[model samples]
Target: MRALAYFKKGDVHFTDSLPEPKLTSPKGLLISPSFTGMCGSDLHEITDGPIFMPKDGETNILSNESLPLAMGHEMSGYVKAVGPEVTKFKVGDRVVVEATISCVDKHRWPNAKNANTPMCDACKDGCENCCDYAGFSGLGVVSGGFSETMETIEHHVVKLPDFVPMDIAALIEPLSVAWHGARVAKFTEGKTALVLGSGPIGLAMTLVLKARGAKKIVVSEPASIRRELADKFHVETFDPSKHGERAIAELRSIPEGGNGFDFAFDCSGVAPTFNTGIAAIHYRGVYCNVAIWGKGINFNPMDMTLQEKNLTGSIGYTVEDFKQVVDAFEKKKIDPKECEHLITGRIKIEDGWEKGFLELINHKDTNIKILLTPNNHNELD
Candidate 1:
């Protein structure tokens, strides 16, 4: 099987001899990927990583897999084969993989160290996204979609609607990330939102807000290119750099009543964006951190104490989040045409390293989501 894999630190490339993935459980399904999106996390793995990936000679605690694993989590594909006990899907069905691997998945990896261990509190409570050993299939748990085929249990697969194109289906994973953030904030219809940074996740937040009926959505992004991309969604775009010290003040004035936003999501994961997201919201409003910060920042408890504002942060999404996002698309809450704006480029798996990964790293600002295909399904004519 040909795959784009992580060989070691700063060493990811395409290889033709990587072992093919197999269904590891009776309820598992083998899938041939149609399209998979390149993520910022993937770039991080190539540049400053092995963060989530196991070390060169080490094995992932959950899946017991080592480095040189195929890399791609945001994927949509067609079922190629199904284990005898898999009743939810059959061969040839179009599907999208949720991609999260956790303690609840012990049944799938019988040889894992924790296979017989009791379920973690989070998994027992149906929050596998927060499971004690939470890791993504592609990131570390096992070989992922950036290959000829990948396998996973039925629990992580979601069926795609007939109207959704395979390429658009790849966007569902990122949208689910934004959707989970909105869920964490307890966002509701008609609420105004302030989304800090219009990068991939930031722009994704804008789309989710619009689909959920946000009265107003203001995307505060410093980069002109990103702001331009956010504007395509018909949401208001704010250049925070222009306002400087008064950025939060200007952001609050955009929503109705001129008080503050009902919800603010920090997708940029920086000191300024974090402060602006918290400060720009009104009393009792919610501020959700959707970004993956690399370091800690100074914080004062009194900031939220006076306002009674709620603070929360979102991490990996649950399977339910994936279902709801697909429901949103099926019911027309999220327009597929609008979702197309997020896909900046597409390339074959053969060119995934150069045209897909390197393109995103070198020209970060110019692209949003770059998808790679194995060309097995003819999704890329």
Candidate 2:
């Protein structure tokens, strides 16, 4: 078996003659990947170096102790072999694996508010994703999608519709992220939405909002290239050319505006976007932060107090969120133009190292989601 393995520091490459993963569970299934998406977070971990690895004390939870860590998570594949305990799916069923991997017995949410660490009982008993110390696949926390063949627990697998193409099924993971975030925002019919950033996550949020029947959608993106892409998706694009309060003013006055929108989502992970996303929301409105930022920034307590808006932070999705995202595509709720345009490029695994990685990091202005098609011996690359 050939797997793209990440070893040592600042290194990941494809390697041949790796040992094949054994079927270890009664309900487990093995899949030969069709397509795998190279995520930004994967690049972050690669560039951030090794000290900050997501490990559980002595154990490296993200990347297994085994050398040559597997490198993908966003993917879809067909079931090659099913365990005896698996009844819902057969050997030839097309499926998309939910990438989140948690301890079978992990935490629970006790009314959404409380105080504690890993042993909060509810945290371990509820769902691994909600646990503060929950482990995830593809982030080096657990093994991922970049292998010719790999095993997945039946609990994390979702069956895909026959009508959806395999390439489209590869998008279910990120769409789940967007679907979870938009559902949290509470946007509905006749409500306005302002999305910051025209990157993959931002555009994903917009599509979900549009599918959910948002009345008007406005976007604030600094890059003109991304702004044009947003326009192609039929979202009302706005430039973040002006700074401070002026930027918000120019954006809000789009259709002779007053006050602003019912919901705003910050997908840029930039300092200004975070502040402005909240400022652009109406009184008692909802603001969802879907971006991942490692640094801190200031926020005015007075603004939050006076506005009385609900601020929510969304993490990864639940099993239910994954289902909703897949069903949206299956039902054609998400537009085809919106989906294809966002997939800026698709390269083979061999092209991923420098060409694909550098383009995404240094040349962020030109691309969105660059997918990597699996180059398995049986599959056509």
Candidate 3:
């Protein structure tokens, strides 16, 4: 099978001899990927990584899969085959995968080291995203969608509505990340939100806020290109660089009552965004960290203490988030055409390395989501 894979640390490339994936469980489905989005995390695996990816010679603790795996988790595909016991989907169904792998998935790898271990507390409580051994399918747990085909059990697969195009379906994974952040923040309809940084996840947070009926959605980004992208989603855009020390105060004035936002999400994992997010929200408001930080930042507990503001962070998402995002699209809450604005480019898997990965690394501001296809299902011309 041809694939774009992580051959080793700092060595991802396109290859033709990678083995085709197989359905390992009775409820599994074989998927021919239609579109797979390139993510910032994928770029990290090349520059600063093996972070979530297994080291060159080691295997993932959960899946027991080694390196050189196909490298994408944000994917939309068509069902190619199903195991005998798979009942929910059949051949030719359009779908997107939730892709989170955790201790609850021990059944899929009965021979693995921890297969017989007890379920983690998080999984037992139905929070697989927070499982003790949480990892993603493409990140390291299993071969993922940047290939000829990939396989995952029914638990991770979500059926796509006919109205949602495959390209738009690939955005569901990131949207689910934003959805989970909003869920963690306990966001509600008619609440105003302040989303810091209008990068991919930041823009995604904007769309989710709109779909959930936010009274006002303000995206604060320093980059002009990203602010332009956020504006296309029909949200208010702010440039924090212009205000310097007064950024937080200016952000608070945008929402009704001029007090502060009901919720603020820091999609940019920096100290400034972190502090600004907390200060920009009103008393008892929630501030959720949605970005992946590389290092720790100093914090003043008194900030949250005085205002009774809540501080929390969201990581990977559950299958339920994927379902709700798809439902949002089906009900026209997340307009598919609006979602199209996030897809900056599309390329064949053969060009995934130079055109997909490096393009994002070299010119991060110019693109949002760049999708790659194996050319399966005629997704590419």
Number of the top-ranking candidate, with lDDT as the measure: 3
lDDT of 3: 0.91
The positional error of residue 233 in candidate 2, measured at the CA in angstroms, is: 0.5
Which should have the higher lDDT, number 1 or number 2? 1
Off by over 4 Å in 3: 379-381
**Could you give candidate 1's per-residue lDDT for residues 25-57 as a string of tens digits?**
999999999999999998888888888899888
What C-alpha lDDT, on a 0 to 100 scale, does residue 344 get in candidate 1?
Answer: 94
Where is model 2 more than 4 Å wrong at Cα?
Answer: 49-58, 61-64, 105-127, 242-245, 255-257, 376-381
* lDDT of candidates 1 onward, in order: 0.90, 0.73, 0.91
Stretches > 4 Å off in candidate 1 = 379-381
Write the residue-wise lDDT of candidate 3 on 5-67 in tens digits.
Answer: 998888999999998887889998999899999899888888998988988788888788898
- Candidate with the larger TM-score of 1 and 2: 1
Stretch of 10 with least lDDT, candidate 3: 372-381
